[model samples]
Target: MRRDHPMPCPDRHDALAELALGTLAGQERSDVLAHVARCHACALELSELSRITDDLLQLAPAASPPVGFELRVVERVLACSTSAPTGRPRRRKRHRLASWRPAAVAALLAAVVGTGAGLLAASTTAGKAPPAASRPVTLSASLARHGRVFGHVRVSSGRTPWLFVTVDDLTGPGSRTVICEVTLVDGTTAKLGRFRLSQGYGSWGVPLAAPADSLRRALLVGTDGSVLASARI
Candidate 1:
């Protein structure tokens, strides 16, 4: 009866996530831990995944379900189910879900497009920089006179050059949009990227147009081209 005891199966990688969530019980939990002990890669992956699970739990607090939430869910489920006419089971998405699919897809597409467009910069002097697939160089930025924005930049020598930059800040508005411009050693500026801030003030990464080590400093510019924030690297 104990799911924490080792199961007969030796390979149950699919259950690792559940194990990390503390939801795998009895033999299932025992098997996963046993496997993790012998497999370094799986153990490492389980540790990494647990961090994300912890982060998400912090972001989304536990709350009571909405009124009639269970009833609505049941109605939706029942409306989509039908008796198997020939004793064959059928699993298909119902038409009721169609109304929201297009809108959701469109919203996702628009965000991606907007993010890409905002990161585009003028032609680079570093010979298109790099594709940002390699190890990164650390950089820093400041918000004019506000505070510091620590960053990391990664650029690889590829045809389409770009910088993958991650920023850090402890104090700022949680939700806002701003442009990043990196001033290069040659006194020319590169479009580092634009970012829409969210609940987290730091640890935001975006693509830019310059190489990792080429910038003298980075500026977070406002709509009117005023430097509101900054980082130096």
Candidate 2:
């Protein structure tokens, strides 16, 4: 008979969602990753959610919000703020009240609205800004060497560009450190970061300092300083 695995922990739902959204960071992210590494259920959920997120990013033709939408949202928030209870505050509620900053409230409202529309809008100021409705431009190239493709690299454009890499069928030991480097338009090479490949397969992502368009190419380098594969961005 086959054995059943335990389901993901209830308390980890929020953390997993944040991780899937690429918002989890610092020690919290490390902690969640550690747990997911050991918990098969959580890892499976993360993978499913991540796939869904990738699908969502590929949605076509952006949508624009109606005029006065921001104004109306701001008015509604102010209306509630002015009408909120002014009576003697409860001792137990002080902490909650203190945590409710205007920016946080606005962010929450934006998130709620974005969730209903299926795409999270980037942060905007008072003026009317274009909605990030369509998917960001993503440039991709295959990582190849000796006429054989071994991996792929992609650059997604935004205020802060991101680089994604995936490697497979690498002829190497089970696990080893691999370096990711980018060649700038000016001919200077910068080391983006490093990641460990497990059993010749792994994927990693990192934010890039240079604009995606400014990168000429990407390289995957082995520990012995050999160029394993290169991709033209």
Candidate 3:
């Protein structure tokens, strides 16, 4: 067989037996060689036949066959020749066996690709920043300390806004406390209803009706009447 072309074995059994006996011609011999290379059972049978042939050749003249030996050999050869027509079943089985490999490979590839895509999506979503801590209080004193009228509102946006505040190191557990107040620039102040802070920051949201635009001038104050930060919306 050529490197690229598969060898044809129309009568696989006879080809295998001839290949074992080393009696096949050029193309037929190549075909049987290809088949045996890929088939362990055929290879073992070929090895056994070769050993038997070698042993027969080593027999002495006194051990030669009787007068009817040639006739018996011819009969056996005819019998094997008659059985050659049954090769179709073996060919069909081989074809069916070969068809499953590509299907299995395709299924494995699809699973790998699907798993990779899922992981990629998960990683992307996990990499994003979380929502800002609820309603944040902006203090006027902190904005004066920083020499800036504008500050950040660390609060999240929603139907009900929560208060979030950050305080400096004072006579408290940390720079954070649960007591704070939110005063808008419009002179309307909403007392800190309920709040909690960790590190230097805390949050709480009061159920008060205010215009969306007025939120920009909001200021957050600590419990000791000190401004923490201020924000415009």
Candidate 4:
């Protein structure tokens, strides 16, 4: 049915599938989101694809392959090679299906550990600085939708107050780099820094000027000027 909407491109379909399967990376995922947000047809397609994926996940894998199925497959291949006029064709499967399971597992583990580490790091800093004594500051923030976290904010025990930012969850690898600015309550904005976040959570420390009164309402702003979060300490 030719509605008023434009059909999504084939590439978008493939991108959507890869993203749904947690395979797309780098520019690919970005391209998918950009397209999906603008195209109603693609958005609908993505919805259906997500539902199909959920259904597939609910379905259990066959307990076992049919008896002798592997043998039969090997035999068929041998028969084809033997029946060929020329010697067994040397053509190789040009592309292979990559398994992201191992990498994903590693990432999941890192996220678990990172979350704990982040909490630990935040805790260790507690009471260490006088400014932090008033209220505990939390460094929690959301990665802008379609955005990536790259670097760590530097926080060291010294006269300066520092806040560290970490990338806990992201859509792609650690390649995505984002520039962020930190704002103090006094209306002073500092371009803290830029960093790349690969797969799991990443940490960075940002040095702050003295006079911790402004730390209460401190905020982390992304490149797009979105307030990721406020410091709890």
Against the true structure, whose lDDT is highest? 2
Candidates' C-alpha lDDT: 0.49, 0.63, 0.41, 0.46
Ranking by TM-score: 2, 1, 4, 3
Better of 2 and 3 by TM-score: 2
- For candidate 3, lDDT tens digit of each residue in 103-147? 222222232222212322232323333323444332222322366
After TM-score superposition, the amount by which residue 139's alpha carbon in candidate 1 deviates from its true location, in angstroms, is 4.3
Q: Can you tell me which runs of candidate 2 are displaced by over 4 Å? A: 1-135
Encode model 2's per-residue lDDT on 1-233: one tens digit a residue. 33255567888999998999999999999999999999999998898789988898889678766422443344335435545556543321112222223343334333332121111111111243332334556677888898898877766655445566667776666778888877766666767667777677666555544456667888999888899899988
What TM-score would you give candidate 2 relative to the actual structure? 0.43
TM-score of each: 0.35, 0.43, 0.27, 0.30
lDDT value, residue 24 of candidate 4:
85
**Better model by lDDT, 2 or 3?**
2
> On TM-score, who's better, 1 or 2?
2
Better model by TM-score, 3 or 4? Answer: 4
Scored by lDDT, model 3 comes in at: 0.41
